[model samples]
Target: MPSALVFFTELSDAPSKAQRELLTLAASIGEPTVAVASEVPEAAVTQLGAYGVNKLLVAPANESSFLDHSLSALEAAVKESAAQVVVVANDNFSREVAARIAVRVDGSIVTDAIDISADLVVTKDELAGSYSAQAQASGGVLFVTLKPNSIEDTPQAQAVSVSVEELAVSAATAPSVRIMATEEKVASDRPKLTEARVVVAGGRGVNGDFSAVEALADALGGAVGASRAATDAGWISHDAQIGQTGVTVSPQLFISAGISGAIQQKAGMQTSKCIIAINKDVDAPVFEIADFGIVGDLDKVLPQAAEEIRRRQA
Candidate 1:
């Protein structure tokens, strides 16, 4: 049977939501083989096994300093294992590595895959997520990047011994960029934006005040997001924006506060499992799609809700 190879970055403990989606995709393709870069912890390996990985391939830690070196190792492993499909988590590093690997192996590359079927037809968003496109790979090895939160997690029972392999480092042109000191952000107790099970978003209706939104998010144990209008109005940080031009999220629960829900805003979060809207205007577009609706000023409602949650927890 043909095999599928799933690539893992060093952050294996809390694998990106995209990585988990790729694992689910690999299971449907064939016996799943997980390929991890060096320095991955044993706990992560155990998690992959629990996720139905049939084989684990670990690259040497020394080979990961350069992108080309990592690709070289992965290419050798793919060829040696005869994997017909390779699924990579869609991120900056993975995209760069996948591009090089695709060129080297002469495989077809598909990015931002939302879904995959038995025939390997991959669905992806196009035109800034205004439309969807479907395509299939014809020959050689196929490479794909999975979108975060697009696939469901379904773990199965499959166990195989982990393997180690070394590939000949290929001669490549020098990269134009050099690494500099990197400062990592301090971790937060709130759920990660992309991986959060629930997300609370604020908008222009909040009148440039995000205190209530932040409080509600903290009470709910979710990340805080904002609409483009709110960000453009300087009510919230750009990183908090969520719309056609902003971050896309598909969480199990999404709560919107004082958001009018433009089409652009809806496009990014329409896929959320459940939606709740808190806006003073009952006719707001946001209320149309909300599973639950509260028509009131968010400033008044948020504090009470937060206090209730805190009281319950206490």
Candidate 2:
């Protein structure tokens, strides 16, 4: 089997759903090695083994917000493993790191990849999900940034003990900028907007209130999202915004409540497998692409839907 490297910057107690998906994909393609920017917790090591990762490479930790440490770690892992295929999370920072590594190693890179074959062919969506394209790099090394929820994470039949190795980062990789201070946002029980399999979003029609949207999202065990209008009106944080200028999500199901369904909003979630739009306007554009739509007041419609969902689950 060919050698593969997977990069994960966050050092959580265990692998996140997105990271598990990356590992699962890597295992399918080749012998998988995981690279992290910080020390791996015991729980994480155990979980990595469950995904068939025998090797865990740790990079020297640094305080730079520029992710220099992460880049150094990936660079060192590439050299140590000489992996033919490299997989990473599809995020802005990861893309930048992958790009730089591609240049350093003279490799080829593909972003937003949805699938990768054993032979290194990448399948991806393009032109706002209009085109499904397959691409292969013409080089010894192939780096790909995979989209979240693109693959399922299945554990190996048997778990193996993991071996940890620390990589030596070169001083030349130091960052030019340093973070002076940071503030952590309040944590939520809901899943991340970008990673959730189901998303419930609201817009200006909510009239600066998200209780109805939150109720439906919470009832379904999904994440809460917001349109640009809702965020700009101080109804929700910008982090919850979903649009061309905000975060993009391709979840299994998407619910749009009290939103006008403009083109900008579709640019972010047009790839969702199923879309349910709720609006009072029967002529709303969102209904054009929706698999299911309700022409009613979201305030009343959402709460009733949530109650029914809860009742069924109960």
The weakest ten consecutive residues by lDDT in model 2 span 169-178
Error of 1 at 232 (Å): 3.5
Q: Which is the leading candidate under lDDT?
A: 2
Measured by TM-score, the strongest candidate is 2
Which digits, one per residue and each the tens of the lDDT, describe model 2 over residues 140-214? Answer: 689999999888878899887888998887754446667888899888999989889999999999998899899
Query: Over all chains combined, what TM-score does candidate 1 have?
Result: 0.84
Q: How high a TM-score does candidate 2 get?
A: 0.96
Counting only residues 3 or more apart in sequence or on different chains, how many pairs clash (N, Cα, C under 3 Å) in candidate 2?
A: 0
> How well does each candidate superpose onto the true structure, as a TM-score?
0.84, 0.96
lDDT of model 2 at residue 279? 95
